[model samples]
Target: MFQVYLIDDEIWALISLEKLIPWKEYGFCICGKSNSAKKAWDDICKNPPDVVITDIRMPGMTGLELLKRLHDSKMKTQVVLVSGFAEFQYAQEAIKHGAFEYLLKQVKREQLKECMIRLFTFLSEQKKKMLETEAYSEKQFWTQMQDQQIKRAAECLFQIEKQEWIGKVCFVASCKKENIVDKKNGKMIQVESFRLFLLGERDENAYGLCIADQEKSSKSEEIKKFLAQVSEQETVWGISRIGDGTQKVSEMIWEAQTALRAAYFSQNQILSYHIKGNGWKKWDELSRAMYYKQNTQVRMQLEALKNEVEVGAVLSDELFSILERIDYEYKKSHGKNLKPQEWIRECDMIHSYPSDKEFFRWLMVFFPVQSEVGSDSAQYIIHLIENQLANAPTLATIGKELGMSQGALTQILKRQTGKNYSELLLEQRMKRAKELLVYTNKTITEIAEETGYTDLFYFSKTFKKNNGISPNEYRKEKRIENEQSTNEK
Candidate 1:
């Protein structure tokens, strides 16, 4: 209910107004009343009300002053000005200051009642729209957050080229709201919500599945009851049989989505997906052997794993375990030099997981060694430098990109990356140059052009200083070594 305050200099008029309106019927309540504008202003400052009905010509901090105060403070309140023809000028100024409705002292009860009703309806509709918009925005935010979290968990569980046990799997659930408008708006149908679960297991490794809890069910029955409730509301769900876990999880999610979509074509309310077998070998077994091989055999097995993930896998304990093991292996291989969390982070990067780099940089500052060598400010400085290096023409160019004075970026880069901007740019240019030398057949001039150096002679000089060898000589040596290895094999 919207609260209302009344202000007037006449005691009889104030009491009359207090008793005139059927406030409760209109979803409003009288919160306070004052004899003068000064008292009303005090009451408002202490306890602001939703609506303020006041006289226009009260002495000492007039109704105009009170209205101005509310406006300056950004208070959300409807103002009603009461005045006679003598104070009509005051009423006009009050309207300019956003008075909701004005009434003369001789105004009738019906006029006051009508004004209050209009105000009530306006506020109610405004509130409903605000609530609906917030609910929609918050839902989208939460869904994106959940999708990102699940994807990260999946990456940690599935290594890029090694299949240790967590095979791919899929889970599907659907939801629908009753009597919602269907396509074309010609008829009413149920709105549906679909959920997919994808996972698997390898050897002794297991990954935990932490789906959002259902509001009206116990933790263990959450997924089951959530699906059941949505189905009862006209939403159908279908889960596919668990498959191999040697492919991208996006494929598995799509497979489960497809299975759920096919429910519309089936007679049964509850359906499960199956691969086309026709007395042939199961795809799961075949994909397991195909994707679970060593890196040397990755190219041969990639297709099978890709197909399994495309069709969705199972949520097995082993799947979670495999991710845990990969995380453990990375930590162990680092010889305790990196934090346990870094293992998960590296896995995320390898799988192209989406992350907030700014947030990640901020988080690293708390690490003991990083705190000593890399302050929070220093990390931002390095990030800015790295970003500018892509097309930096000079130290001034880097500074301009970072919105700093001419030499400002240079000092920060020297402190953070331990080199001036020019040196760092040359270093990165040479690093790319080396990659081209070893991995591609690009010539010295082409590599130089690609590395932002238009002049090949200058590029060669920078490369030699960084690596202590000319670019051509380095490529020649690498070519000979590869040829020798191939011949021996």
Candidate 2:
């Protein structure tokens, strides 16, 4: 949101401007307000806001002087002057010198709104052209140059495939489960310790390429694992082991990719790569199956190769294929592509399966015995909450686990499911409590503990408040209902 700083000599004008517009709806935020222009300058210069509003005839420093001062000081804040009829010509002259626009005294909301729209739109265009966002994947790690002339110069300087980084250990890492906000206005793509590069394959937010100092490669992997554990995201590190200093960049990348491939097969977030010379037999077939959009063929190939490697590789591949088909069909029907990443977070759970059979079972869960396609059934955030419920999961704890703050976590939950953290947690707990009440002989205390509450009295109170009955009464009522239905049948 664009930040706006307000300055006016009259107190009423300041108050009216604050209430004149719902600023946020127009993508503007009122950052600071001052009745004195001289006093406001000291505050504004501390951190220049995107836009400044000032009364043309102020007590000491006039709005025209402030506007010229802003330009002289090299601050890029756009200034809008509020003026009376007498100062109309003066305001227009200030605009020629660089004021954004002049607003008449007693500014109407719609009039002010129209001026802001023009100001914001102009500023946005400038910012966009100046800074473009970047996301990195391993495949295109080396070729992210923006200017075609500069890229051609670099191409002449170094061979694309054979460029050498002799002493660096090239690696690719994944943070699939991390609740990362892919950095925006991204002149600097934030991937924990890794820097950003444009990725040609895989979700860029979930993966990054980093080159470690060869001597500290061992320590790097350990530190990376520790960080991933804290975030509860399985991080795969495909290390292109300490080869001779002459290894070409392409060779190291291939080795690192091979290591990552092996890690995926092991159902690991791919923490470390092991050099493997014996490649899989059906790799070509699996790749082809995925390419041809043959979901069954991909699944069959995966099952055949399931016992040969880790379940992670198969499921990840299977998920890509399924998403490919979904995106393809959606495009055919709706005339647009729903990018594969939309369906990917649902399958990030692929790291959990321990056996080949889990592949079929998991597929059944999503695609099931239905003639038509189902809408998105993946509860990505809810699943994370459910997994940690017994541990007395709080929003802060969950946020920490995902490398996000409590507020960021809340926003994500609200955006995805139209619910807040407390509501979602309450629903999960009550649903679990109900299942226990109807299906198990556990006491209320045991159920309370299982549902993440240690205080039985508090749990009982909450259950009654939400369900309109105490635990025992709910359990007895369910049992009576079951018996009556059975007898009536």
Candidate 3:
């Protein structure tokens, strides 16, 4: 229940307000009470309550004074001002000081009740968003740490050091919803309000992790049942078996991922990590056939790979290597690559997971512009950076979002686009600044904020460095053409 604090100069009024409505019924607990606003301010500052109802006419410290103090101190405790006077100036002052609600001395039960309901809703949404963001950050940290050796993963997990989790282990699962395009569309599936941490996107799959509540007795079946409810048709979940604690999290993740891929053979359901596949032992045989252009043998070896991957006999890496080799060889002989999407379907085969970069490449493999072009990963990175420009997103933060480190992000961007991250970020911001200048009527300062520049002077200087003109000059020159175009239109 949300905590509530009540303050009034008159004892009668304080008791009346306290009993005006059933606070618990409305999701609040009247935790503290005071007859002096000054006294209440100290308690609130020491340990802020979620909601504070205070009399505005208190002698030592008026309700407005308390509200101002809370605001200046950066406390989120919401204050509701109550007074006998019905002055517009008091209401304005209350609003200016960030009072959650203002009520008269003769406040009706229903009016206060309605205000409590709004506070309840507002606070609930705030908590939910905070939890979700924590989930993202925790998963981001997990990914960053797990990429290191096992000891590092263990060290990171123990740093959590949650006493309740110390003796318990969770059956980690990797889940994917096939048709998801973006987080907005993809977040619709909630497995009975279970905690979820989205990892990242690859091809048609939006992948995430669900660490089931460790206290549940039948957590394995519990997770599987909930996941099955949301599976519908396009979702698949893979669960790692309950195992030893913290030290095994990395292994649990690997097992869940391998199990998720193995689930490709089975249709829409949850599968547990019970089987292990052979490593890339047959790649030599398949690669030899592809290099010799043994069309019949290549087809046969590919079929062999399909069987092997289906039954967990071989890793999926070899399977893709064979197909990519086939496509490359076919392009060599016929001057055209095998149509990937069509050939995959015609061959009636299953697929294993590829890295995000490879997946994007495969998406555009058949297009003519595929040659001498950068991967969509770079564009995705730039898009994320632009969206976070106001916060001045840096490489470390953006890299965490993509489950990559700053070094990995730098290497990939440089290798793919022949440009470093700062170059891309500056290019994106300047381009956005140019668009807003020519189109929007926002002030230069506003444009600077929009482009991730907090200092107006710095923004103008950088604009000149990149575009050979200050922001105002660029705006003047571009807006003429823009105005003429608008006039014609």
Candidate 4:
């Protein structure tokens, strides 16, 4: 609703206007009323209204004077002037002051209503245009501001000249699930908030931030309070405490990100603060051993494994070998016993995966791993079944072991594997029967019993479906092949 301010020196006239006009119907509400222009101007300045209806002449300040004041102040209030005396000079002055609608006090109610309607329409159109322009400008401004924030953050870290003044640097924390406040204006956006924050001093610069919105706290208190609140929020954060300005802020950013990575393995969900220690101060002693390190080669091998996974190629031992070498070099360089076995296990898991999508999903559950492959329900179900098939006597039993009802598993297996439980079982058993037929001197009845089919004729039918020949025919062919191989040898 449009807010309105009513001003008239005559108390009865103000009362009459208040009663006669259907203010709500015209999308208006008389937020305030005043007996003099001075008082009205004060009210308007404090809480400006959309429209102002005022008498043309008043004792302290005339309507013309009020209009001039509003114009000078750049208030975009729509004005309507009401006067008893219809002087030409007053009408000319009203027009000059951009009065929306001029009216005589003795005018008929119908005429006044018509004027009010026209004014309302005109004001409505102007409001709409203004809102559209504001929305458009807001979008553009926000986009540019975000870009500037990223650039400034990068400069604060990487640009060496900017680092000399910085006393300490901080990395603001965010989450994938939470909303991100705009770095510049703190405006809320709908996008998923995942941003890296960089704040540091330039040469000889120090700024303080309070934990709350009150007066700024001391630097130490600010850091402590910030860390305390972050802990209470149960939100994880990777932070670098006060450090020398000699090291680049960008390096701190990278370290902070690395800290977050390490934190991902913990259950705290809030690794609130971490500060890096000396970078091998025993440099000459460590540098002598560093020559034997294979850091570059290890990183390259990891990249190759990542590339193979990205393209949905089968995982190779080459990737595992690289991880092992990296593990070895890391142990030697840091003089900390790094677990090559852990890397070996992780590599085995990745390499043993049948497809990239499964590997990627497993990675997402533990660590962030990207595979440019989409999921297929059929392939996934088959893989799942294949993994669990060793524990059950039949496909139905396997489905039950996997927490699915027999019917649902049956339908899913049919849709995904293109074979119903019975058919799949028959195929598996038929292969077992063939192995018995060639490798062991088992009778047809014995073979049938061993393959989980008590009925010989039914077993033969299933054998034909799988091998394109009956059990006896398959056995005969195998015997002939075996005899020929024996003679050749």
On lDDT, the candidate that comes out on top is 3
Residue-level lDDT of model 3, residues 323-363, one tens digit each, is 66667766775475553322332112343223322332342
What lDDT tens digits, residue by residue, belong to model 2 across residues 389-457?
A: 665457786555445678876776677678887898889999999999999999898799778887999
TM-score of each: 0.36, 0.38, 0.35, 0.33
- The digit string of per-residue lDDT tens for model 4 on 251-271 reads 444344433333333323433
lDDT of 1 at 174: 31
TM-score of 2: 0.38
Say which candidate scores most in TM-score. Answer: 2
List the pairs of residues colliding in candidate 3.
none
Per-residue lDDT over 1-489 for candidate 1, one digit per residue giving the tens place of the 0 to 100 score: 688999889898888898897776577878789888887777887888889988877778677788888888888888888876556677678778887887887657999999988988777776657666865664554356447855654454344324333432324233222311232422112212222232322122111231232223223245445455433445555443344444434333433434543443322343345554432224334334333423223223333333332333311111223335433433444333212222232223323222223322332321213123224434554444443333445656434433466665556667666886556666666666788899998778767766777678888888888788999999999889999999999
Off by over 4 Å in 3: 150-489
- For each candidate in the order shown, give its overall lDDT on alpha carbons: 0.54, 0.61, 0.66, 0.54
lDDT of 2: 0.61
Candidate 4, 382: how far from true, in Å? Answer: 54
Task: Order the candidate numbers by TM-score, best to worst.
Answer: 2, 1, 3, 4
TM-score: model 1 vs. ground truth: 0.36
* Residue 460 Cα positional deviation in candidate 1, in Å, after optimal superposition: 96
* Worst window of 10 by summed lDDT in candidate 4: 365-374
By lDDT, the candidates rank as 3, 2, 4, 1
